[model samples]
Target: MTSPLPFLVVQTALYNRLKNDATLSSLATGVYDFVPETALYPYIHIGEAIDTPDNSHDRYGGQTVATLHVWDQYKGFKRVLQIGSRVQALLDHQPLTITGLTHIVTRYEFGQPLTDPEPPGDIRHLVLRYRIVTEQTP
Candidate 1:
């Protein structure tokens, strides 16, 4: 049988956690892997992910770095920042239920705020990243 991918497992766990979070749901419209064309403003999206092998003598392991984007049509960075903070609280150093892998730890990498310069300049974007370490379940 093929081994489960750590990147996909961690990303799926993150998506499910954020989607089911009551506080986050109150702040953002939705958490999505694929944002709809008509998706409303103020939403969270699961972005790019990169995985690196971290195997031991007799076991398989990996480090997965994932990016999450918070988008808002607000005039200032306050709204996006608030939502980003909530996300950080949920994931940083928290336990994740990744399928077929033993989750080691999740660290909050960084969060950056930027303004979208295209056309309507009122869009605020917050880019958040997390590093998750995992090992294959024996």
Candidate 2:
């Protein structure tokens, strides 16, 4: 009866490194420890079943959509642009992991309109879209 947004849990340390390094060129360049087996959390949702007859009862199944949000330390220049490009490339090749998932960059945007002036420092906002299959653990 409840629907939750799909999410990926990455190490805070790894995230911090990526956040701090203003010049990180690629995800491959960052050092991240492999996630533990118990850390995988797959989301679930209820929707219409694909193969059940319309007149039959209990014709509903579960669906899941996984996504992740990566916030990088703002590098007050072209760092946003650079990081976005690198992430896009990774998604195109499905290189984020070795199994059970496919990732694609569905959208990318920048700039803040609500705040009068952006904060000072090397920081940037990044939004990444990905699709994951939960049949196998990654």
Candidate 3:
């Protein structure tokens, strides 16, 4: 089975790029922008999962659930960015929906730390969870 960590990394990178890319911002009409660390402190929870068949008949399968946490100073902006049209493009046309969002799952703040001792400012962090369906072949 393929590791979900790699997919998570790729997904996170894509989100960061989309949030920072000027062209996407222009096209999306500034729907996304730099987010702050504090705003994301509450943290947003995203859920995803995948199912894979175990038998040759393809009747039975196992499911894998993915969870994500997002943090940004601009909570509203970050949420909007996550559900923006750009995500559809990033998925290469795959259907991904922002089903729901829960703030402050835990008391942990996720994001890149600042070079100085001071806390990272305006840094948005997100944790996303997803499920993927895989077909088993004999």
Give RMSD to native, each candidate: 1.2, 11.5, 11.5
TM-score of each: 0.96, 0.34, 0.31
Whole-model lDDT for model 2 versus the true structure? 0.31
lDDT against the true structure, each candidate: 0.92, 0.31, 0.36
Model 1: residue 135 alpha-carbon error in angstroms: 0.5
**Residue pairs with clashing backbones, model 1:** none
Regions more than 4 Å wrong, model 3:
1-61, 78-85, 92-128
Model 1 per-residue lDDT tens digits across residues 1-138: 344577777888999889999999999999999999999989999999999888878888899999999999988999999999999999999999999999999999999999999987888999999999998999
Worst 10 residues of 2 by lDDT: 43-52
lDDT by residue (37-134, candidate 2, tens digit) is 44221111111111211121332222233233333443442454455465544333242332222222222222221211355533343444333222
Model 3's C-alpha root-mean-square deviation from the true structure amounts to 11.5
Error of 2 at 111 (Å): 11
Candidate 2 contains a number of clashing pairs equal to: 5
